[model samples]
Target: MNSIFLKAVRNIKTLQYFPTNVVRACGATKSLHTTNVRNDLMEFFDIKKNWNETNIRVGRAWKLDELRIKSNTDLHKLWYVLLKERNMLLTMEQECYEKMNLFPNPERIDKVKESMDNIEKVIRERNIAYYQLETGETGERPVEDVVNLVGLQEKYEKKEYHIPRFMNTRWVQSYLDHGLFNSMAIKKFYRLYREKQHNEERKARNRDMNHVIQLIKRFPDMDMEKLKAEYPNVDIEKAKRSRKSRGHYVPKY
Candidate 1:
């Protein structure tokens, strides 16, 4: 009877210890699982509250000075956040436009664009700095100023060539040959272009001057400041001094 009682007591102790160990193990497992879930959620998306807001008031763009201070990882995270915000704003604006409603503030798009641009600029600056430190080069795309076939100077981005410059007959003929620029056809085209531009300018000047003349003729006491404001380029003082501006009545001098 004594041996049986001792055996029963040992079994009961083992059973009680088993529950305590199991509870501790379960608690540890739950802690590990909760940590993993929190990290996974953080990596997946932004905070939830911004999901359903009619108007999200965000501050201005990240200025270059502000961006310059951020570390690479911080800047990378910021870039994605701004990108998602831009996409969201664009989607909302499109929906609003589709409904034929006015977008409350179209400047929001401009602000987002400015932010993205600043981000890109910051990245580019860092890249250039890294490149220069390691390789002594700005690491930027090369460009050159060249005269086109029409004899107009233009900025051209330079690209690699399989053959040397002297060996490229086609490029040489197109770019170096003065005959292309001095051709009769090109000259005629340029002349016509200039004449068209001149005609447009003349028409605009006459139209504005005539409008000013009518205003002056109708309102002899028209304020010179107001006239100047209305037609900034029209030399108001010269127009007033013109014989056309004189009234029919004799001079009061």
Candidate 2:
């Protein structure tokens, strides 16, 4: 009977210790699992084993037509893959620079970027088609043709506002009531701009005319059709009559 009591006491102690050990084991397992997951995630930024080698070959960028054939879910997943690839390439490049080593195959970065851009374009096309089918709209940013403060036409993207347009005193005054775009200073600037543009055009014409004259003086038997095509803006016939077009030698005309 005494042995039985001692055995019961030992069993009770075992139960107490067992829970503590189990708890510790569970905590260790949880920590190990977390660490494994973290390592897997870090794989996104890792480069290949042969990255440090001299020559690294890679494939071409994802074409738009190829991406278009993929399902939306597949495309979405591919975008993340490309994004990870770009990050990895950038990381590898930075590391190589830090170590004063050559980065292998810089075009890989371009390929990944191109693929990402194509994926986005495909997604956008799908979005537009879906929106048009359901809502009769492209579901893109709404734009309106507007004249800017500089009197130039621009497509103004519509944005959300808290207050009504009429209630916005500062905006109304700047763009409408007391707009500086229509001021006398702007008119003066525009006049000067126009004069500068005219001067440039005049100078360009004179330069081309001079070139045509020089060519004729040098190459008397030059292809007239080719010369005319080369100097479309310059009056070739008028240039031929110029004194500069005549060579130092006696005219063969």
Candidate 3:
């Protein structure tokens, strides 16, 4: 009977220990889960203390080199964090502006924008590198030089071709016949363009010469070196030969 009683006691003790172990595990798991949730929430936004502050102090932006070393998942999470922070700052700024109050530290917006740009640049660099490694080509849209109707060369981005270049009749006819458009009008346009450019240059030269002549007339003892330094484009020797440059005083010789 004592043996059976002892066996019952042992079984009861075992059962009690099992529940204690389960309870401890459940408590630990709960604590860990709460911690993880708190961290996630904290990381997604700024600290709670900064919520109502007029001027929130922040450090410099994340450098491209620093971000490049981080893993892709880390970068992705950081982007969303920055994006939310930017939106919040913008909202606060707009509110302050509406209230006719000064928005402290306006440079913060510029810093955040710069950081976002750097992040995108780094991502593009990585993408290009990966593409080059895999496909032996830079994965970007191709650009080409083409002449426009105005007879000026311009850059045009090439697109995918379904029809071959020679098969397009409209494109071929446009470039083949220059006489289809009035050749006289083109010549007249070119002549006017050249005349406008020449007039501007002539006016600039005359203005410089007149200014130099006035300077000489006003300051008879002015330093020639200073005049040359001030107007590098004006030829001092040619100015000396001008009738306006001759002083009214008679020659002593």
Candidate 4:
């Protein structure tokens, strides 16, 4: 009889706890149903309401002057915002192409890019100014005129490398003997290149001379000073002696 009473009390306790557990579970489910699920990445996209629209209007990019007034901290934060906006716009554009739908306001991407470019420009200006003030030099890479392997001049930006100049086999080979540019074949090619350049210049000069002659033939009373100003390279007196410059009605000086 005592064992039966103990069993009955245990059942009573289970009955009491069972309802509370069920109620707690039910409340948890209800809370879950009421809660909102957020996706941060999708925030890069425009709002859902505008997603299917054919056209989405947006304002112009951030101007340089406007950015100039902003503090560096604010500009830094704004850069991220513009970057995110650009990424979102690109994503949307790609999706639109994939779906065969038109990307609304394609210029929005341009605006974002322009804004980012302006931000970079402002930052560079600040960096340059800071460097000038502190070190009497701009923080930008220094560029100098360098003769390339083919005997052409190029603007070379000086860069620092871990290796020494002598260790760079490729550079030494290109600039020194046994290189293509140092070979007889390259010398012939360079000669031909110079000839071609000379031929083009000669042709251009002849064409200009002929054109000036025609102008003189057509307008006999044209201002010689103006003609000289326009075609300073042409020998106007020499062109006047040409048979073409003697127009049908003109013996007029």
Candidate 5:
């Protein structure tokens, strides 16, 4: 008898809480922060008005400068809100693809990502500041230049080791007898790699010189001061000396 009474009360409460129109509205979604039913699965869908709309215009993303002004507590709250918004947008995108519908305002996802990135940047800046104030070092992991087996430079994060290099025979052996970088082939590869890098630099320098000569031929009375400032690496005098820089009209230089 008690169970029957409890069931009847629950049915009445459901009807009173969710009317026919309100229940139908639950099928559509808006911001969970604005809605009373945050845990509802239907929150993944777009609002009823936007469901059939061709355009869903939104503003620009949060800039790093704007985010930096916000407090940490506000940032933490906003992070979760953006996370929920991303979840809803992803769900709607997938649904649209499955149903062969045009996804509206797809760039909103990028804006949300940009905002989240700014938040992370602000947090990282705060952490770095706090750590530098307390200790003389940044809290970020220490990274240093290291050479790989291919003799290429790489940024390697330092790891904590329980033992020293001398005590760790296996670690020492990895860099000595068994290391691929210690081979004659690796040395040859490094030499070839260096030659390729130098060749690229030389080509770039020649291109800059040729471009400057062409500029001198084309625009004889162009701003010499501005040109010098633009290409500090290229000597304008050498370009003016070039025969290619000679045009129908003589250069001002």
Candidate 6:
């Protein structure tokens, strides 16, 4: 298994998975060392150990803090390493499932995914910082609230284009010629959608009010502070004053 790890690591440079341009973009130079890989299907299938064994050993997933400390080049390499590991784990799992065998330590998949996610987070942080320093803005895609064709407000992620919307004939034709937004059906849909949303909000408010009243009635000496914390919208004092909140018990004077 250890030898397999080395083989996979060595094979990464030769597999053409990381193109020269991409590696250079990561500020990584080509590794001086080179070794031959079998270049076989076993690369994906048999890389992971303990496929049939109950006791398996592997290191913990990469933590966000740990990954953040590593250089971009190291992260670039680690990302691909995790990517290959993930691919092998999925392939092994599928083969095991098809063969009616239980996959050992399915949590390995989650570990790889978490590591990849952390690495991405670190990369994104570095990117945003670099962009802010260099260009006075985060390099992430610009997003804004935009009304869709259906009249509902939604997030619109802007895309790069060679021409502006008004100048783009295809875009202009599709949006301007098709008066979908002005149709009676669309207005009716927008009206009904807004009404449905408002109705749900109202029902939820009433339900919370009724539930608070019940709690007040049942547990007269209950922890009102905790109840208030849980349902911040419920008016505890108002619920206490409500007729339904009065207990159905006669006090022994």
**What TM-score fits each model?**
0.52, 0.60, 0.49, 0.59, 0.68, 0.68
**Residue-level error in angstroms, candidate 1, position 120:** 1.8
Best by lDDT: 5
Lowest lDDT block of 10, candidate 1: 33-42
Clashes of each: 0, 0, 0, 0, 0, 0
Report the CA-based lDDT of candidate 5 relative to the real structure.
0.87
**Compared with the true structure, what per-residue lDDT tens digits does model 4 show for residues 117-182?**
999999999999999999999989999998776766689999999898888887787777457666
Q: Say which prediction, candidate 1 or candidate 5, comes out ahead on TM-score.
A: 5
User: Roughly what TM-score does model 3 have, to 2 decimal places?
Assistant: 0.49
**Which 10 consecutive positions of candidate 6 have the poorest summed lDDT?**
25-34
Q: TM-score of model 4 relative to the true fold? A: 0.59
Q: What's the true lDDT of residue 125 in model 5? A: 94
How displaced is residue 135 in candidate 1, in Å?
2.4
lDDT of 3 by residue, 1-253 (tens): 9999999888778758786555464576455433244534345444568655678677898899998998889889888877987976787677677888777777888888888888898888989999999999889788999867655568998887888877877876776655524567766876797899899999999999988987776666779899999999998777776778767764121
Higher-TM-score candidate of 3 and 5: 5
What residue pairs clash in candidate 3, if any at all?
A: none
Which regions in candidate 6 have their CA more than 4 angstroms from the true location?
A: 1-38, 46-49, 53-61, 104-107, 199-218, 241-253
Tens digit per residue, CA lDDT, model 1, 1-253: 9999999888778758786555464577455433234534233333457444555666777799998999999989998977877776677677667877665556877987898899899999999999999999989998899878886679998888899999998877876765788788888988998999899999999888877876776678768798899799897766766666667855222
Error of 2 at 209 (Å): 8.6
lDDT tens per residue, model 5, 1-253: 9999999888777868877634445663343334366667878877778887779988999999998899999999999999989998999899999989999999999999999999999999999999999997898998999887688999999888899768898867766768778788889999999999999999999999999999989988888799999998899999998899999875455
